[model samples]
Target: MTPRHDENTVFMTEQEAERIRNTVKIRLQRCSELAGHARETRDSKDAIRQATGASLMADMGAADPDSAQTKTQRGTLPVIAVGQPYPPCMLPLRDLQPMKLSNLRMDTHHRGRRLAVKRASPVVTLVARSWTMVFDEEEGGEIERLEVCLHKTRHGQDILESASVFVIKEPYFTLTDQGEATLRIDHPSDLVVCQDETANDILASLNEAKDDVDGVTAAAEKFARACKDHGNAALEKQNLPLAHAKYTEGLKVARQNIVSKSNPDLARDLSRNRAHVNLLLNQLDEAKADAKASLTGRQDQRSRELDSKAYFRAGCAAYNLGAYQEAKAFFEEQRKLTPGNEAASAYLRKIETRLHEQENGAFNFQKIRAGLSRSRPRADAASFVGGTEVRESRLPGRGRGRGLFATRDVAAGEVVLCEKAFCVVWGHEMEALTAMTYDVRDGGIRASPVGLTRSVVQKLLGNPSQVKRVMDLYGDYQGGGNDNVPTKMRPAEEEGPVVVDVFRVHGIVSRNAFGPGGDENGVGSSSSASAGLWVRAAYANHSCVPNAEKEYAGDLLVLRATQPIAAGDEILHAYHDGSSGDYSARRRALMTTWGFECDCALCAAEAADDPAVLKRRKELAEEADAFVGREHWAGAKRVAVARAKRLARDIEGTYDGERYEGLPRLAARTILEWLALAGQRR
Candidate 1:
């Protein structure tokens, strides 16, 4: 009987159909020839099985017989009997390809237990001592019985109850000898709850029920109070980020409550509190905005205290922003709200003195500096990493630009310099929105034609002083005409016709901006690696054998000496991952990316072909690989440590100084880990 075709299926012409039939016939003929040869040669069972499988697949129109063997070898297609039906249990599971849960049989010993669940109905039950989630196929066709062992935690309990449908991503699966499959989720994010339309409907209903004016008001108030309490706790602990986050959350909740007509006074209080936190964070503009927002429609006696605090915060922010007249008005209002307030009175007097001085022809620089110093928080002198004094000098033959030099003796592991980024761009959304070409390696915004233009515009809008500092860095753009900057980015009214500031800033950032440093904890992720401009860090020249290393803590970049640096030694740090590759690769990378030929001590030695250096490195790598392949952890550790020490010694010998110190330390730590593992095995 001829099979019927669906309307959606394209009907083939007689010529096309005939050609396909002829091709199939040819394939079948070839399979028959191979089978004949197999029988004539009296091949082994394995060979015969392969030949038979290929023939069967060709006859069934599954694949070309000639390519079947190749596909089977590569595990792309399974080898099965020609006419036999595929077992239901052995069928490829959708979304769970590569590794299926049903494949985890008790008799087989699998090293890795990483499995992705396609679709599952998680039936959670509270067993004695623990909770277990039995994930079954959605259709309940196969009773494979995959059980996920869950620990007793508030979050875990909540998940077990809430997660009915789940897609367990990269879960560790283990099968016992008795064919009992157990899945373990080490991280909460690994298990994704598949919320279908029904789940969304239920959630929507619940949200609607809670959206009543009274209910919303009460919930928002409670949430705001809790967030404010948490913010206060974070402030006490000196976790500025956490405190800011909590205060922001409280403000959001307070705003929501205000929208529901719950309590305007509570919203005002939250705004006032948030303003205080913003002031502490040195976000003067944000503080002033919040303080103004807090006083927007409030004139009640109950809100008098909040008004006083808001006025003071606004005044302080305005004073820092150099809006003396506005600051004076706010301070006067604050003083009036709280009679006999010494702090408010003192600030008012200072504002008057500053106004009077400004009106006169003479300006007292020392007095202004003292007043500014008193307002700003002082950095701990002992905590300073690099000494405050670093000199920049032209180093010929090194590069076209100047290199930073250490003025004083810098000890190993001492921070040479710590400076906050002038401007930083991060996150996928911002990176995509900003017209910038991003580095594929670290996912940092690169200075593309469009991206740099946008960045310069953003910087100019933020602060012209910051833009000037960025422009001061070494840029490839030589003095050019006004056409370099886009017409849209050009300021409407400028003293000079030259709008090359954008081009200059872009070129400078392209050459000098440090790649996003690791997080505060020195742990890096795709999201954390950002591009930032550090004026001081940019001056330190690049080196394959650098004496110092750059560490990132938030927006701040800290340059630390890896080894003891002499008073007059040039402070250098690697611009790339220098420890991974040999000298040749490092030089090529530097030349290609930064437009410079590296002549660092290590690169120089490598170029001259120092006998037994590259050869020894190759041998050590091979030895480590062989040891690891044989599961000889001790041998692997020893070889790795030796390789690390040899590299460090080579660097020290070439430069006559200790460099690549981290390589040896890392190798030693790895050896300790291997020893610990060996102890566990014993």
Candidate 2:
């Protein structure tokens, strides 16, 4: 029998209320899955309704009149959600097998701060840092600790937390030269955290594990050596990618060792080993840089041998780069360090021959280098935009300026372009710009917006042609092309001739740079987000209803078409979040932020003073809302789907072919939610 509530109020046990909450939560989560699987309105609507009903029951504090009796009769407890409440009495570390703790506080030495505990979100630690520590639990509850380096960082961080206890299944273990064993956590999902009844025991276990710092130095040494061995093994197997991965892992481990100051030899060895791998992989510049790094500070017999190898690698990279003289010099140093080295002798001969050929006018060094440069890897458009073929075109009447156009017919959900930013200035990294300044040689007079502008100027100084390209971008400032910046307070630099290229670059950046979405991962800056300049992507004009959408993956921007675009059609992208506000709100944002009034089809129709079209859209919107308010999910879904289709038709019917494409996409999403609710009703 259903429990009765008083006329004035209802009383319920906390446990019963919790059960009801759990049931509601489960139903809601299930609804999300149903929505994902929903294909048609009828089936989806039924699922959505059940989900809605479950929510209403939970909110109203009503018992599942049938569920309670059925559950009691069946002797089954309510379904528990994953990763909630600590489990009772810690399992033996061996029984747990691989111990994985997501979001657990790992003791780290960062920036001179010893034993600093920082939250290592899966992505932040694994993907960004590429390695973490693992603890081994013994039979008597004692913990054995080892630092593990990861071969890859492609794991997701959505469910990984620092305070959660994770049970690692089927762990892979490797022993270093120092005989310390380290466990690897490769898959993000491999770490499972279950609800615990004795949370204090688990906390104690974790504390014991962290406090057992004996043999940490030896363990770290072993782990770092193991990483290098793994890399070398991968190299021997001719798996360059795996070798690179291992080497990278090893480098991270070596750098993090607290005893690193006492072990300069190991650090030098790690760098040299990675440099050798990079050379074999044809990464000439990286190889050269690494080889140079290995030679910095301290000299011993082991160091000298490593230095010889470094010189050889550097020579080979320089030879590939067509720097014959530099290559010859490095080869000579290698030959001096290791007498009778045939490879170095051979390389020296080759350099001498190349130089002789150049002197004899039989070879064009510049031409050969240019040809080599052409053979180097070209950046793929898919790297930034995904895979869309768009071309820049002038839009005369719109006052919107240059815009991207479709080169061929593009289907909905097609990736149009993937592009890396030409230059990115992260909000937090802006401080770095402040310290970067150019001063007149004699007077030390600093320019206005000194830091950031100076940094940009220095970058431009490195590449004059890039400066020209930046100059071509639109600048809102009304300064003459050759004008020198005028300084009122400066008798400092004779105030006569200060080049304003820094100011010009600043203006161009202000006008065209995009503030990309998402939190910065401390890769570039401490800021939560960054602003970047994508030279080609800058050509895409803004529209309130855009056909193409931009997504940021780190520094890369991906552009995907939301609707089918025919050949020669102008490609449009949204500059702001399109989901918020109505037509007028969108227009205001576009005008204020982008400095343009949108004349897209939706804007035009509203401006045309057509009451019938306006009234119908408003009415359809109201009908959808009314259905939702009444819990009539099926009706709401049907209305939403119809509204989306109608909007699409109106966009297609427009004479100019420009559209407010975001509306239909937003409507489609709403329909999916309604479908989930409707499916629940069934």
Candidate 3:
């Protein structure tokens, strides 16, 4: 049953033995790679042993072997013993759909280590993937309510629908899903099934406002052709904002296409383009998810290339979320995939530098924010970077035109205006509403979203920045010497009201940006609504012609207007899409939505908005097939070097001159080398 080398062949002559030793060295190198990976992952001795055990089980049957050489040969490698499990750098995930993963969002560029108190081992997280409901055969259809690893996949989500419990790193701790994780439903009615129209409305709203929330979010049955056309024309733009608009459309199409898809490949391509849209939109997570999904639905060769991008996206997410270790792993994988990719290398090195700073306790918030603050400064005050009118009322009665929009032309991604944030009360007097109380009946309904709002406010009260902000405002007001204005909010009134600095906020001024951003509004509301709390950021409104965008730099708020503005063009901001799920939903749910009187740019456009435009676009795209074809590149390259004369500041946007200057030279060299090869062939 066993085949073995003869004893005579097992040993060899000295020269032959030398060759054998060289071959053995390669095997040892493989061992080193495996061991090194284990070491790099911060794997415990037990984990390392487990991995090796699994490997040995594959190499030779899972049998006990006393000898070291035999155990290693069979892949049962030994590991350094570890003490107690690394303290759980994990937190309990809230039992909510579209789970909010409890992670420490930090700044790696800051020159200080992120200090955190780790809980004892056995921490748990609710998986984000399991948010999707699963359909069952015997059980009919069911929406699963269970928690798993913080980062489970859709596959995992489906599996969790039926399972009651799960664990991460077995033998440490297990997630008990019996109580709240899995809720049993007696009949199909227990499930929240919606009417066809309601589902359509919800879907439509989500699709339309996916990016720069236009009114396109009203019909779920009909696809939003706006974003689709934008996607098709996205890559054919010289202007970045025009390009951004196209990408934004592509993003909406990609997202809408997902839940209802006939071809996974097309979906994947759309998804890949959507990631680019996310980068443009600054929606990092969605971008990453799209990128990963794209790789899954493509061919192997393309998949590998896309995986490189997926890893790059993961690194970006980890870096943004302050997970240095995870970021490092992702970056390293990217480097391995494309050894000379400048973009990847630049990011990789930056993250490595950040990791060094993090470990050394040098995470500097001001420095990080300062760097984050670095952006193109637009000169115009009448338009946003993409030339949208995104301004609201400025200085109360200075008049609407006195607001954030520009009177001149501005460029892409530029800073427009900056204003310090505060709860300003002129003259330090007048009876300001310190506390406003409202009564609610005991049996009244309290929605989950509202509950979430209340909880978030409670948490914000405990945050240091919020505490400082409140104190600052309190000192500013003086409360007319009434002790009634307590320094610290009562625990019972934690969600009463608070102030914040909003930046580059889209849409209406009442609503707040939440989740990832540091300055989202929560628990702060006033009756009459007075329009609630208006961030100079959110004060802007929707207009067919937007002027400026609200952006933030610490407590400093700025408005960036991109295009030229005449004396009168209703300055407005696009209400953030998905800010309230969708358009009609926003109209029904939100009491007040303002900016345009009614008509917007999208509403008025005739030619571009025409149905013939869609058909013409398809024809034009088809025409391009005949108009364009691939050119050939053969043989070696020897790039030529040259210097160019100085040029005027045309300011259309250039790649720092370095890339432009380098390209022609490189092309010239390559051409010369090819000619030389042709001469040689003669």
Candidate 4:
């Protein structure tokens, strides 16, 4: 009897998978033809039009075995695998690849907007993930087979998902199939899925919700005017939550209605206020989204995508979603958008630390609650990252420069790579300088780590001309608590968009932060205690054995993502990596850059490596962390240096390399120790 192709019979593999290491060879030659033809089409909307862009991605897609199909049915895909494809400990993507063969630098500065690429793991590995085609050698003609299994979720949701299939003629190059079959996720509770049908209404509601931006000042004045008469009235006696709700509603109105083309100040304020209100209500994700929206006014194709706010918002959303990987990605994107945004990157690093704590059973709710008072669970300074102040920088996309672009989907644990403007030296001794010359509201001030000049620090001693600079830093010039406005006029309780040659932020501490100070080769200085305080440290992303390391001397922070960063990968340090080295996510993140499969040695070793190895690695990590937690600076530094040396030696291939050991792990250990000490001092 002949067997049917339905669920009745199991599909058996007739031959071993044909692994192809030379995926790009055939496609590379074809790319020349595709590129020439792509130029003739002249359209950005379609993927097939591009010879290299989507064309290359398509070529690679054709080789995969999974057959992604568009199902018309409302059924959802069942859980193919639990959690992630691989466990956090066994992330196959973290393995670092060889140095970039391309000398291309996507200068996003011309775009004047924030841009990011997929950050790669600094650690190199040997195990490889090869794409292979396994087909039946027998069964006469084309045989149908049943293999995949399914399940039903809580709400009687049956996820009938099927995998996609394609011929594996190459490894990385995907050919356009135009059609295929795969699983579908019917996010039953997704906002985009449900409210999309009424986009107009959704937008209208959003607009109405943002009306406060235009009238908030007037409303505040009215409240102030009526205060004398209504001081003892029922409105004054209203509950905190209720009154808070009213202000919250007004704040929301301001965010949606802000116009980037017209009221840049209003738009920024509204967006900022709404996010703050969200925080008051504990709606962290919503607050973050609003913050991100604030930066779009000055964005263009080439510049960092949005202001720092957008990154903070996206990062918060990813964190709340428990998509730490995604959250890290967003933060990396934020860093790329604003290389000076230390607040965002620091928070990104913090989340990594928090997750590490949790995974190691460090979820001490009581301790967390206690710590909450000292440091909020969310990453940031005393105020909501940045108060309502917004600055506008022209986007670079309008010009003819290669813009910095995101290479892959970034997650929170991942670091986003960025380029730093070279430093301008002041004196002749050639002493490496890490100082910020601020044009503060009230005075002339020079901020640096503890080692900087004392005379430079003493410049603010009773100089009459310096008063304005000093006052501006604290948000006042006329001894009044408003923006750098005129002496007689007041701000009416709401701040306006600043336009003075960068006023109100002469606080050398907030501006001109420290550089990450290193590169992909892991050649650089570790952060000094004080230098870590510079806000610029926020922009210096994490990478194991990073080309740059955020150094702290006293109060300065410096950045560096050194040479050897590939054409597509975002240079990064391990996120709060301490005890053991790069976990599973590290290797896979590197894979995200090439837009293909990864069979890095560490990832390949996951199945066979003793689980105890991972457990022991994490245990040692915790022990190492305990050193920093206890303020054992010497021990922490010792551990950090040892970790770096070991990884460096391992990279040189002198020792028996493990599944995961390299610069990434070492950097993670170093940063975690620094952060621990930093947190304790504060």
Candidate 5:
């Protein structure tokens, strides 16, 4: 059976799929012939008419794949597979002929917003091939070609370079609303660069001197130094991708020359510069490898400064990876090479604190809080790993998904989970950057998802091995596939490359990302609201009467149990501000924001309460608030205390004791606190 273009399952035969492809090719050929004649026609009026007719025929032929015109004609022809994240490990390559740019058409099914692709199974193995081409040029000043928008693309922006050859799998070709043809690649895994030995054929096609603008044919040392200088210049301008690319190009040229191996200084320097760029780009594994490569050359007085910097980069990369011991050793080595290095000394101190947290779970929350208030917060702390585990959430109405659960009995007020955010976009950064996106539902301008989304994608692309950290979390996904995500990280060469669907990342960010500031206790000032995604912490499902409460320390989310929880109990928290006890208001908020109705103990009890009784309770609570405000009046303390007691008692009477299960009454607690203060004053 052949795969269907509009669905995941196969419904057509291989012969039928071929017949449809031939039909499409014949029709497109006719359209091109008509267009060619229109260009050469002698009569001006006839040419214009012919050209318009040819365009209409093309648009009709390529009408969104789901549209009636194309669907009726195509009838489930095998297209490319899309809308799913890539496999965690690589699958064996399949032998399939490549699709060309000429055969591309508008994806009317997705309204040209995404790619239309299909997967075919050869026996039991499913294989996808790619279209190879050299990047010709970028469109205008946008810096994105053959992909969706800058923010939506994998690796963020400005990654594709002119003259670089790469393969694009499951490519989406369409004519934009403005009538320009484009090839859009939605997933980073879909585009693989052809470099090193594999890129030899493509490299041979280009002019050597023109392509080697940095003098690749010159002496190995001279060429390597030129690349280093180019990389350093790009770094200064904050073009990290270009700097890394230049350094990479230089390394390839230098490594091929035996002369460079004899005098490794230039080669080592190139690697060191690339490592620095990789570190800044959050490509931890690459940065670590580059740093190690930089260390192999002579470490005498001449190269002492460079070696020290390499050690420092290695330490930072290791620390980010949570290899505290290795990071400590790197820092210590750096200190030995250059005594009194302040940066290395600071990292050593941080490593000591991280080690304490790793072994004993002891943390200085007070110190972390102090650092969070600075204009530029430092949340470089590592997360604790063993307190809770991700398990299947056993809730009835909720679909098959994972939840965070306590691994052991947790006492009230004890830290249940402390996780550093995977990526955080500070409020100040958003404000200064002036990047804002409006939400039609909220009807207000808010912090754009681009900043936070880009940061997360950069990290994921830089270190694809860690893709599961974000991918494993629940998100706004429909029936794309099963929950059989790989449990263990695998090497790409052994299995296959992990596929990162940018759309999947965007969906996860929307459902799981949190606004970290708006209250006094959070990291930034109240006026500026920051956004972040905490991968592990996000697994906790929402409950109105949450078992755990969240607090912030820098970019870290500290979850503490508000009530004693059993070993296997699922951790839960409120997704919104639950200050208002109005049942209808709470229900509306939860349903609108999270797409779920609250079914927690409190919501269940409140759902059965009498409307009038709840209304009276709200009225009395307001009266008590007014009375508490007049406490500064002369001779009013006694009256205020008496009224507060009556109001608290009245509010208590409104709630059914068995239904509420002795949940704290928000209004009653307020009045009781005021009465206690009044008694203390007396």
Candidate 6:
């Protein structure tokens, strides 16, 4: 008999639930073999429902219907919902090993889990406690509860809710600072939420209208063609991600179907189109592979054009990766396939230029500057670099790592380096200008780390050949391995499936990226911010009184000597507007943002000054700023000019005389400039 209670209440004891389960088993056994199988499934479900209700009531500690204690009880765990059936295209979790949370270790990444939320905390950035189902036996199961947290993902907080099922890919189990066990996911791509649309795709990919080979071939071709058309439309609209996804989905269908051989034409076209998309997306390795795939299969004789486009894509990928010989061969083949191919001809010339630049430091910098003046920047311009080499820093502190040094004595105003930006993202191209909070300590909603990070990852994943160029850059990786960042650049070799941790990429971008500033020399300034990463420039260390200045022209970065420096002197530039702020303020800003304290000569000189003197100087500087900010009273220009001169003198007195002997009094320069302008007006 079912227990009776109020509308929202159900009461039953453990013994009573056990009796109901026995009755269900006995009733199921009495039926015929085929009938018994059907009865067992239904009766077993009914028994579980009753037993679960009793167990939940016990967990809630609800002894009385109207008890005050019931209202004050802890939040109850949500009952597991039977999610939509697993898709036919995917192998069920039962077929593969699902990771047991109980076996997890600290500082390790573990794989496998089909999770159902038991309960979830209010997501700050996506967190939940999920029940991991264990399908150890054919007829029974077990559950292991685990805490999961997704960090720095684009998914909204509400994506994790009660009873939502998910399949965690390469779940990284680790301990938080508070000594709590949690499965932390830093990459958004790591978690695949099992949504209805995703389920439908899996089902649709498997289904066929007719059973014959011709029928299967027709179905596959139709789906692939639709994907290609949709992808082409998206590409035309400049929706790169969507186009890549569409092409990928079409390729997935082709891969799963058995009758793909009967339709090589469809497969060939899909690969070729996807290759073109990959090239645009900066996925060079995938582009090259797809390009090669497009040419391997039987040709579509009905279609008129030669496979010159594939060769072009392959050549472009190789060219960007610094494989000039391979790129030259591919471009030559493309020209042969289609006579009068201007793009191929152009790339061949570029290859020659690149080969010449690599052999020696000679570059046609004049030609590169010509392209920089255009409204839309092109990254195809040849790089010009000489007189500077990356070497270990000779600073007092050994922790300064490496620094750039002049190969020869460099004169003031002489160009030391000019190189194209590895990747650049203009602010106008972003779909939404939503502020992303990576963390509070980093000053929140930074210039444009998100879009730039995505661009960097795509490029790295597509071209493993360029791994050595990037992997050596600094980041905040604390994992057990070498953090995948080599101290020295690794030699160029064939690498398989590079594992890029997005968190590491975020850290690197935060440390080295520059935003648009007022002038070419104003790197890391906040004016009209657009984020770009310049590979060679990242090696230079920071200094308040920098020896070098940076200037940007389109996607190109040119470094010039601000003062004459002998060979072996380390090159440095201001990471921010380090000239305006006082010593303490500058040090504080650097510490908070970059997690480092400045110990340069200028900083050390200012650090030795009397605190009272520094404080007075700061006050006078503020007064001068306030005086010049608004129009003064009639005939008060003389008074303002006098105050500005006095403030500039006070600020100059705060700097150390001996240590800062040759360095410019940068802190006082602004006030002095204002004073000079005021005198001119008088």
Candidate topping lDDT: 5
Candidate 6, which ten residues in sequence have the lowest lDDT sum? 80-89
Q: Which portions of model 4 miss their true places by more than 4 Å?
A: 1-265, 297-306, 354-682
Against the reference, the lDDT scores of all candidates come to 0.48, 0.47, 0.32, 0.30, 0.59, 0.56
Off by over 4 Å in 3: 1-229, 232-262, 297-299, 362-682
TM-score of each: 0.38, 0.35, 0.24, 0.20, 0.67, 0.62
* lDDT minimum window of 10 residues, candidate 5: 120-129
Better of 3 and 6 by TM-score: 6
**Higher-ranked by lDDT: 2 or 5:** 5
Task: Return the top candidate by TM-score.
Answer: 5
Candidate 6, position 559, lDDT = 78
Give the lowest summed-lDDT range of ten residues in model 3.
640-649
Residue-level lDDT for 351 in candidate 4? 75
What does the lDDT read for residue 76 in candidate 4?
14
Q: How does candidate 5 score on lDDT?
A: 0.59
Ranking by TM-score: 5, 6, 1, 2, 3, 4
**Model 5, residue 53: displacement in angstroms?**
28
Better of 4 and 5 by TM-score: 5
What value of lDDT does candidate 6 attain over all alpha carbons? 0.56
Cα lDDT, model 1, residue 263: 68
Residue 30, candidate 1: alpha-carbon lDDT: 49
Q: Write the per-residue lDDT of candidate 1 for residues 1-682, one digit (tens) a residue.
A: 1111111112234553344334434544444443312112112344335434543554455533221111111122211111111111111124343445444433232323334343233233321111233423432322233333222122113444454555554444433212223454423333454433332332233357644756555655676677778878987887665676667656655665343266676666666777787677655666787798888435676566678888999999877645678999998898777787898998888787656543431334344234322122121111132443445555446745667787778789876776655555442223211111323233222222223233443444323323344555686664332223332222211211122334345457667765553333222222222466667778888876688998654445668889998878888888874343345555655664476887765565556654565555544444433433445544345554555455444433433224443333221232234445555554
lDDT of 6 by residue, 495-517 (tens): 22344555566667767777643
